[model samples]
Target: MSSGDFSLGDFVQRALPLAILGLALIGAPLLIFEPEGLPRMRALSKELAQVKAENVELTRDVAHLRAEVLDLKDNPTAVERIARGKLGLVRKSEVVFQFGKGR
Candidate 1:
């Protein structure tokens, strides 16, 4: 081994750090600035959170509607209440009164 001659081991130790550093310098900007990078990931995360919240709200609405349907199906008074309030219905024996509009 001569002092003036460079060995393969010495060459690798010198070149490896420069190679890794060069790759990092080139790759960091691509990760930050590319369309499919950090920005896309953040956008998708926000969309997922919104969708999950909507799903929770819809689930609650479905539960409430199911209970109302069950009540209407089993309770006659509930049915009559809805019919009277929404359809302007009355019993057959009920009397009616009419008044003229006053100016």
Candidate 2:
């Protein structure tokens, strides 16, 4: 066909594919990288990082408590003091008296 004889059918066929491609290009970024999509991923990443940090802190605390437990186990004086106060044990020379509001 001649350039001046461009028909509506030919224009629509060319324009439809271009319109669909344009819409796909525009919508792809919104679907993949828009705030609604990316913000949740970013928030999850931050939460994962915080949870990892808390895990590390809890691990350190557990290690410290384990060390303290080992120290108490190895020390007789510490064990004796804990037993005397917590278990209410007394030596042979110590006087045992009960003078309290309940008694």
Candidate 3:
């Protein structure tokens, strides 16, 4: 009860068990409430963050596509250029020629 009666060994014996019990109490949440552990939680959190980042990137891409669609609707030249490049279209007077390298 008194410090005078407690030897160093006695003090350590009492303190060590109390310290272990305190650590166990502090660790209970990390053991039970967490699905796996701190590492698993960190990995899941990182995955969620990456997904959210990719979602943001995809949303930006959609916005860019919408702007391009609006531009194509308002500009006939842009539509023609896209069609000419992507679909290989040509005007009535345009000549189509193919030269083979094996000649």
Candidate 4:
């Protein structure tokens, strides 16, 4: 309590505000601009958005593939189309035509 004595209570009263202010000064910019803070959050948000878009596209592709699979399983015409296009299969009664030069 003497005028020349350093006191814990007095130090806390004076230094706490400065410490709090300094921390805020250092922390506010991190919240706004630092790569591990706001910037990283924004990057993650952008990545999530991209992943969601890709998921939608993949969902559509999966649906289309499923429908095609069902068609190939049940629709004779679809089976024939795939066989002719992918496997080069022909009906027994169909004539084979070759116009290109043989390798």
Q: Go through the candidates in order and give each one's C-alpha lDDT.
A: 0.95, 0.91, 0.91, 0.94
* Candidate 3 residue pairs in clash (backbone atoms < 3 Å): none
* Tens-digit lDDT track of model 2 for 7-48: 999999999999999999999889878777878889989999
TM, every model: 0.64, 0.54, 0.63, 0.71
Residue-pair clashes per prediction, in order, are 0, 0, 0, 0
TM value for model 1: 0.64
- Error at 14, model 2, angstroms: 12
Q: Write the per-residue lDDT of candidate 3 for residues 1-103, one digit (tens) a residue.
A: 6857868898899999999999999898769667687778888999999999999999999999999999999999999999899999998999999888985
Residue lDDT tens for model 4, 6-43: 99999999999999999999989877886688888989
After superposition, candidate 4 runs with Cα above 4 Å error: 1-18, 101-103
Indicate which candidate wins on TM-score. Answer: 4
lDDT of 1 by residue, 11-61 (tens): 999999999999999999998879999899999999999999999999999
Rank by TM-score, highest first: 4, 1, 3, 2
Please list all clashing residue pairs in model 2, or write none if there are none.
Answer: none
Clashing pairs in 1: none
Candidate with more favorable, higher TM-score: 2 or 4: 4
- The per-residue C-alpha lDDT of model 4 at residue 14 equals 100
Candidate number with the higher TM-score (1 or 2): 1
